[model samples]
Target: MKTLYETSLKESLAIQKRVIGALLMREIITRYGRNNLGFLWLFVEPLMLTLLIVFLWKFLRADRISSLNIVAFILTGYPMAMMWRNASNRAIGAISANVSLLYHRNVRVLDTIISRTLLEVAGATIAQIAIMAVLIAIRWVDVPNDIFYMLLAWLLMALFAFGLGLIICSIAFKFDAFGKIWSTLSFILLPLSGAFFFVSSLPIQAQKYVLWIPMIHGTEMFRHGYFGSSVITMENPWYLLLCDLVLLFVGLAMVAGFSKGVEAR
Candidate 1:
């Protein structure tokens, strides 16, 4: 016979899964209506952006600037950065966008943010995989040297992105103006994420400072997995993991506090 606590835990898990599933479907429809291509745009949007960047870089003689394979470099770094950026960006207005749904007993603030973050992360992941596969088939990019390491980096970045979304969403909820400008701020900071350049490419002094930013570690780790011994990289996965834990702790606390004050409009 199951204890009351066990029964409650199972019921709660079931409810949360059902709520998240429904929210995921709602987001797909809301963001991309029943029009042409609809949900396909989820990945297609990021894939197009990545391809454009690749084209421009190749056109601009990026290959001349680095010994590394420019296509693989861009493919590895850009999409990982996009996963976190897009996830955090999408999480900004999640609660307000779905406040009506919160009227339901099972739906809560965290669920709303999680749903949006999951959508954005999934889109970025699919886009990254699709592009990598096509490029590999065309012989434009070599197969990764350490696929498991790359997967680990990708998973850590996803968790980092989700934690970041929670914190930023909580902040934006309090200061509405911050929400409006976060996109611009994040764009300006994108280059510092080590997506466009490798840590080894930077000066010795700059590398130390750059490592302080957690996103760069994820990017560097990912590139290390792809490029292998072909390049030098400085990525400490443990540091990124510590940062993730701290962010998740702070972000969840802030959300729990602020969420109580939130009222359906």
Candidate 2:
């Protein structure tokens, strides 16, 4: 009897793995099928955007860029924010994009959403790493003293991104125009993300305000790793960690609340 139960359990595990694997492969291939560059564009999109910003800013600042020497600041800030943006935004449309696939008994909602998230996250991380490498090689940016903290910082960023993604994915299922709302809100939120400038560069009160935004903390933490200096004066590692946890739970709650209805659809 125990052997039979064990066999059953193994079969179930194998089934789940097969489902997830198929979904992951389908999601990746589906993305690349549209374009010749395929996966290359994933890296190119963010890389070009970051480089364009750097070039324009450098030009606009002219000699002043070297004075402040904030290339590392931009590199750190932009990629961290972009990671969250890409992951969550892709997630927002994940259900809508792949709703047909959900009809297949083997293609579970979790598998579908996760496949999308993994593609976006993989693309975002690679883009960030490539840009950082180029900047460092060109002497346009400085290196981080602590690899461990940078990894921790990045891991936290991914958690926050995934949390936000889950929440958005939940909403995208039930609402008709959630995508539009998400886009508009993100436009408004971009200025506050601290991507273009350091939080410390803001006025004292503004500094306090920006620190309250959890996304800003991710940037600050990553910048700290890179520069060996803190970006925001109000550095609370614990607070940031707490914020990530809250967002993640909130996301999970939203998913749990809406998952039944979603499956019903």
Candidate 3:
């Protein structure tokens, strides 16, 4: 027989799971509609973006920095970055967009943000797997040397993205202007994320500074798995894990503080 506290906790968890699932379905239909591609666009959107970047880099980047396959390099790096970037970006205005739903006692601001972030992460993950499969089939890219490591890296990045979305969603709720400019600020920060370049490629002094950015660590760890012993990488899984924990703590606190004032008009 479960204690009353345990029973209540279990019921809360079940309700939250159901609420998030419903929010996810609503988001998919609202964003994509029931037209042609519809919910397929969840993966297709990221898939197309990754393909365009891969092709553009393959053709236009006249200089070859490494002997590694360019397609493989970008494929491994960009989609992972996109997972976090797009997730955090969509988190802006999440409360406002789904404010009406919050009128329901069980629906919450966190649920809205989580649903959006999860959708972006899911889309990017699916796109990365599908593209890797197609490229491997055609011999355009080699099989990853350590797939488990890649999965771990991807999972860490997704957690980081979720935490980031929560923080960004909290901030955006408080400041409408900040929400508007985050896209631009995030764009400026994207290159520094190590999406397009290897951390080992930087000067020894620069590498230390670049590694301070949490996103770079995930990118490096991911590429490390894909390239194996062929390349050098600098990624401290503990450091990124620490950042994820801090972000989640601060984000949840902020959300709890602000959500009270967010009445549905």
| Model 1 residue 202 distance off true place after TM-score fit, in angstroms | 0.8
What does the lDDT come to for candidate 2?
A: 0.74
lDDT of each: 0.88, 0.74, 0.86
Error of 3 at 166 (Å): 1.3
Give stretches of model 1 more than 4 Å off: 37-65
Clashing pairs in 1: none
Top TM-score: which candidate number?
A: 1
Per-residue lDDT of model 2, residues 83-115, tens digit only: 778787888767666777777776666666677
For model 3, where is the 10-residue window of minimal lDDT?
60-69
Rank the candidate models, highest lDDT first.
Answer: 1, 3, 2
Q: What's model 1's lDDT at 51?
A: 76
What digit string (tens of lDDT, one per residue) describes model 1 on residues 1-265?
A: 9999999999999999999999999998888776758667655765676678778877987768766776787788878887888898999989989998878878899999999999988888887888889889999899999999999999999999999999999999999999979999988878889988889888898889999999999999999899898888999999999999999999999999999877766
Work out the TM-score per prediction. Answer: 0.94, 0.85, 0.92
Candidates ranked by TM-score: 1, 3, 2
Clashing pairs in 2: none
Between prediction 1 and prediction 3, the one with superior lDDT is 1
Off by over 4 Å in 2: 1-16, 103-106, 230-233, 263-265
Off by over 4 Å in 3: 35-65
